[model samples]
Structure formats: structure tokens, C-alpha cells
Target: MHVCLFDIDGTLLNTGGAGALAMERAVGELTDGSDRPLDIPYAGRTDRAIVADIFRHYELDFGDAALRNFLGRYVEHLDEMLGQSPGLVLPGVERLLAHLHQREDVILGLLTGNFIEGARLKLRHYHLDAYFDFALGGFGDTHADRDEVARVAFNTLKAHRHPEQIDLRRLWVIGDTPADVKCGRAIGAKVVAVATGVYSSDQLAEHAPDYLAEDFEAVDELLELWPAIG
Candidate 1:
């Protein structure tokens, strides 16, 4: 079987502005100084890493209690923000997912930086959750490093299927950031870079991904280059 793992933010959905605003608000709620800017550099990072940065910026000690409180507020407001301002799935994503899902040899899963619950919330909000099997995902809760998350995802897939034979070489990782490409490389999965986020096609091209596309719009060409089915 062929396993296809996808990144959530900036790849499948457009939550850039909402995510930034939510982080800013979360920081403001925790910190005394309103003047302190919430520098939310979200690209190519895990939620824990971002939260850690926010805590450091506010000079707050990183502890479970503080982290939990911040996450609680962030998630509460995140759902509200998403409800008020719905995000869009990238072009051709729906069609691409449909095509891949029809194939018997393919398995769809997520390898994202979002915490598992956070990931579910985004997918559920976008109504994209049904396309994925959550049992096969790797999330920020498992590890802060993106590569490690990819490794975890692979293991999850293996456990779910319990395949009599397994071939890691047949795995694929799809995303829109340099970190995604790096994670794919780390785990030796075929990488497909989509220029739908911060990096342009030229920038992603420098990384020499096995496949690169402007967006999911070129679904036919993308699949032709690296078909999801094994």
C-alpha cells in the first residue's frame, strides 16, 4: 500500500490571518504589557514551538500550568475566530482528495505541526475531516520536531494496517513549506512541494523535491508525476 501524508495549515487550508490574530490575542491575555508584540512566526513550525516562543517573549516560565492555560484560551478563541471567519481549502484540494480516495491502494493521513485536537478542530471546521483517517496522523502532541512527527505518522500507519509486508520507500509526504520537504527527506519519503504558502515555487525548487506544483489546481499533472497509489 502507498501512504500519503499531508500538512494541514497553508497546504490544505488558509488560516494564516486567523492563526496570527488568535496567537496575538492569546499572548495579550497572558501578558501584562499590551505593547509587547506577539511575534507569531508560524511557517514551518509546531504548535508547541510557537507557544514556547510566545512564553519566552512574554518572559513567562514554561510550565505545564501556563502552557495548558494558554492552549485552553487559544483553542477556545480559535474555534470562535474560525466560526466568525471561515477559512478556505486550497484550489483543487477537494478534487485531488476525491481522486486519491477512490484508489484502493492509497491511504490518506496527516503529518502536521498542529496538536491532534487542534488539527481535528481545523479539519472539522473546514469539513475536511472526513477525507482523512485520524488514526494515521502524527501531531505536535507526540513531538515538537516536524521530522519526528513524520516518523510517528509512519509508525501509526504501520500499526493501523499491520501489513504483512511494509515498505517505507513507498511513502509520500505533501506540504507547502521547507520544513515539510525537510521532514520528508529525513524519513526518506517522496516529497511533493506545493507553492501555496510562504515559499514560492522557485524557493521550494531549490530543495529539489521529487514533485512541485503551484497549487493543487494541477492535480492531474501532480498525480501523473507521483501517483498516490502504489
Candidate 2:
């Protein structure tokens, strides 16, 4: 079987504006003064890291208590904002997912930086949750590092599938950022990068992913170019 691991934020959905707004609100609440800019980058990064950067930029203390409170408020209000203005999924994502779903050899999983609950909320908000197998996902809660998350995802898939044998090289990580490609490379997994995020095609190409494309519209072409799995 061939396993396909997908990234959430930029690859599957576009929650950039809503996410920034929520983070800005959370930071504003944490610091009474609005002078601190929440200019932290979001693409290809974990939520924990993003929050930490925000705290650092604002010179605010981020103890466990503060983090917990911020997270609670952020999640609650983020959900509301998403409900009000849900973002658009990338072109051909729905069609590609449906095509892959019908294939017995293809197993769909997520390797995202979002925490499990946050990941679910985003996917569910976009009505894309049911298409994925959550048991195979690796979330930010497991590890803040993307490479560690990739390893966790591989292990989880192996444990769940109980494959007679596992071949690490057969696994594919598909996403829209160099970080995603780097994480897959860490585990010797093939990476397919789509230029739908902050990075351009040339930028992602500099990372040397196994495959590169504009979007899922050419997924079939990508699959054709990928080496056959055992």
C-alpha cells in the first residue's frame, strides 16, 4: 500500500486571515497594550511555536497558566470566526481526495502542525474531516518538531494497519511548504510539494522535494511520476 500524508493549513484550506485575526486578538488580550505586533509567520510551523514567537515579540510572559487561558479563548473564538467566514479549499483538493479515496492502495492521512483538536476543527469546519483517517495523523501535541511529528505519524499508521512489513521509503508527504518537505526528508520519505502557500515554486524547488507542482490539479500526473510502491 502507498500512504499519502497531507498538510492542513495552506495545502488543504486557506485560514490565513482568520488565524491571524484570532492570534492578534489572543495577543492583545495577553497584553493590554496593542503596540506589540503579532507578525509571526504561520506557514509550515506548529501552533506552539507560533504562540511562543508572539509572546516573545510582545515581551509577554507565557507560563503554563497564561498559555492555557490563551489557548482556550483562542480556540473558542477561532471556531466562531471560522463558522462566520470559513476559508476556501485549494483547487482540485476535493476531487483529488475523492479519487484517492476510491483507490484501495492509497491510504490518506494528515501530518499537520495543528494540534489534534485544532486540526479537527479546521477540517470539520471545511467539511473535509470525514475524508481523512484521524488515527493515522500526527499532531503538534505529540511534538513541536515537524520531523518528530512525521515519525509519530509513521508509527501510528504502522500500529493501526498492522502491515505484514513496513517500507519507510514508500510513504509520501504532500504539502505546500519547505518545512513539510524537510520533515519527510528527515524520515527518508518521499515528499511532493505544492506551491500554494507563502513559498513560491522556485523556493520549494530549492529544497529538492521528490515532486513539485502548483496544486492538486496535477496530482494524477504526480502519482504517475512517483516510483511504484511494493
Model 2 regions lying over 4 Å from their true place? 63-65, 163-165, 225-230
State the displacement of the C-alpha of residue 179, model 2, in Å, after optimal TM-score superposition: 0.4
* Candidate 1 residue-wise lDDT at 28: 84
lDDT, residue 95, candidate 2: 82
Return the TM-score for candidate 2, rounded to 2 decimals. Answer: 0.90
Question: Local error of candidate 2 at 164, Å?
Answer: 4.1
**Candidate 2 clashing pairs?**
none
Q: Which candidate number would show the highest TM-score if scored against the true structure?
A: 1
**Residue runs of model 1 more than 4 Å from their true location after superposition:** 163-165, 225-230
lDDT, model 1, position 76: 78
Number of the top candidate by lDDT?
A: 1
lDDT tens digits by residue: candidate 2, 111-204: 9988777788888988899889999868876466889998898888889986654566668898999999999988778998998888999999
Residue 67's lDDT in candidate 2: 73
Worst 10 residues of 2 by lDDT: 221-230
The CA lDDT of each predicted structure is: 0.83, 0.81
Q: In model 2, state the lDDT of residue 206.
A: 99
TM-score of 1: 0.92
